[model samples]
Target: MAPDPPDDPYVLHARLLAADEAAFREVYEAYVPLVLGVATRVIRDRTAAEDVAQEVLSHLWERPLSYDPARGPLRAWLLVLAHHRAVDWVRREEKRRGLAAPHEAPRGDETADAATDGLVALRVRAVAAGLPDTLREPLLLAYYGGRTYRQVAAELGIPEGTAKTRLRTALRVMAAALAAEGITP
Candidate 1:
């Protein structure tokens, strides 16, 4: 393939903004490798990294306005986007693994502890199920979903402060309920 023109990124960006298909193709072919490399380095999983790279490229195509020429070159912007997406992927995987961790049987002779933990988890889930939806949503996202309060807020379309408040309220209600039921830790 011919090398990308040595034209200024601003010009290419303008072309992209104008919805020139050829310009977008050129940018995609030119920068995909670099973006993939950044994602692979951060994600450390080739398949997951490639997924992030594809998502970053798709986002660039769908939201060309997200890129600003004054910030830096297009290449740098693409690399940062790829890196952030890869990091987010890693965070989500970590959360999934963490949520499953408590359910896994212990590796050694801690069968008793594992059993106890399972019972506690069951009770917690039962308590959570009785919570109002507004309070339950944030609590599940933070505790079971392994997301931060900010993430819970973003996912639930609420302010971060509101997410925090709701999670706290849910926990307090659960605690009181558990105490009333004589379900002590």
Candidate 2:
């Protein structure tokens, strides 16, 4: 997980708007992983995700006023930006590859993505792969392994509340990832 932001967003936002290098660095250190993680969950390419993270952070540095403090917190705003950028990156890649739509099947000439099959399947794998082990293990066990949450708690030796929270966090992560991809899940 990314470290919490070093200071209140408004303070940071003000410093950023003034082009403070220290403020930018602090924001980068605190949130780059989170931004990259979101991008990676959608993109599934380390290089591409790193590019997305850089673009997002650079946008923050170059146009800090674009982030409005009135509407929401800076962190949520950054996540939204990251999501949009990742989706845009995927769309651009698909277009460049001659695929008409994101969900459309890749052409026969295109590489098979190592037998991953459909775009949806690849995206599912990406999202699953991006989840933390604490979240992913229980998610797979409960959903794929057909275990109850109580059983998940017992198996992981965690309290039931922790199990439930993990499940909830996992679902939220999936939902956010899918939503970023413009999928209704």
Candidate 3:
């Protein structure tokens, strides 16, 4: 289980946006495991998962205002980002692997693919339902739908800072909820 961030998520997020490295470190330490878990689940490669997790965190640092509290919680937003990056990595790998099999039939592993997709969808839905609507929708857009934070803000008609605050609040709520469920976020 990851330790909770030292300050409330909103305060931590504000600090992070202001270039507070220590606050950013707290966010990184608290959520890296959850992000790595999602990445590993998709990529099935430890090294690649680590790389992707770093990339996700880096993205957060570069675009701290993308997280919106009104749209959903922060954990979900980060997980969604992790998941999308992992999926993108997997897809790129598939493409690379496919290039070596130009003469082979398309990898028609339909059943397995369908099952995996179904399971991911179900889990995402369950997690989203567990979140308040304010945190759920924006996180979903950024994470699951692969929209950028700017895009999410545009769609929600809110300023980017507000979006980030919503995202942080959402993450705090999720962390608490996961704790209650005997799970760590």
Candidate 4:
């Protein structure tokens, strides 16, 4: 039979909670591939995905208490962290490329205009990322997913009124996030 996998994640987490370096290393080794895979799937850039994977692993080591077993399994938590980080990276990259939305190109010197556009786009994406899933799901479905609000409600299994509420709330939250990011939106 194949050798048994490493110790239980809870056991490993317990060791981690105790500030055991060895335990952190063990967890890192156990999950790095899975974490990297998740990050790459979302970021679609090997270098950025590696960076996000490292960030996720480092966060786990630095903040062991952040992982509460009650919420879910350790693996799931790690994957979630990886996914979020990857999304952040993708947003940042989108901002960098000024590809968050389409608009007329800046009229100034091309390089300077591109830089300004990038910053604005980045802020937009960062704020969008702050939106809660309740609102985000419907908004993404309606906007990026190219679905109508009705379709979004159907897909999310929420009443259309609830979906509309969520979409409005999400937009409000995104606007606030943008303001916080120092952009007028």
What's the TM-score of every candidate structure? 0.50, 0.54, 0.54, 0.52
For each of the candidates, give the backbone clash count: 0, 0, 21, 0
Error of 4 at 112 (Å): 36
- Candidate 4 matches the true fold with a TM-score of 0.52
Residues 103-133 of candidate 2 have per-residue lDDT tens digits of 7632321222222234445455567767999
Off by over 4 Å in 2: 1-3, 102-185
Q: Considering every candidate listed, which one attains the maximal lDDT?
A: 2
Candidate 3 segments exceeding 4 Å error: 1-3, 99-185
lDDT of 4 by residue, 1-33 (tens): 122127676787788899988888777777888
Query: lDDT of model 4 at residue 4?
Result: 17
- Return model 1's CA RMSD, one decimal: 17.1
Residue-wise lDDT of candidate 3 within 2-118, one digit each (tens)? Answer: 666868778877887898999888889889998888777777789999999999899889988776544445666677677667766876777787753444433323543454455
Q: Compared with the true structure, what per-residue lDDT tens digits does model 1 show for residues 94-132?
A: 667784354343221143234334545655777798799
Better-scoring candidate (TM-score), 1 or 2: 2
Name the regions of candidate 4 deviating beyond 4 angstroms.
1-5, 102-185
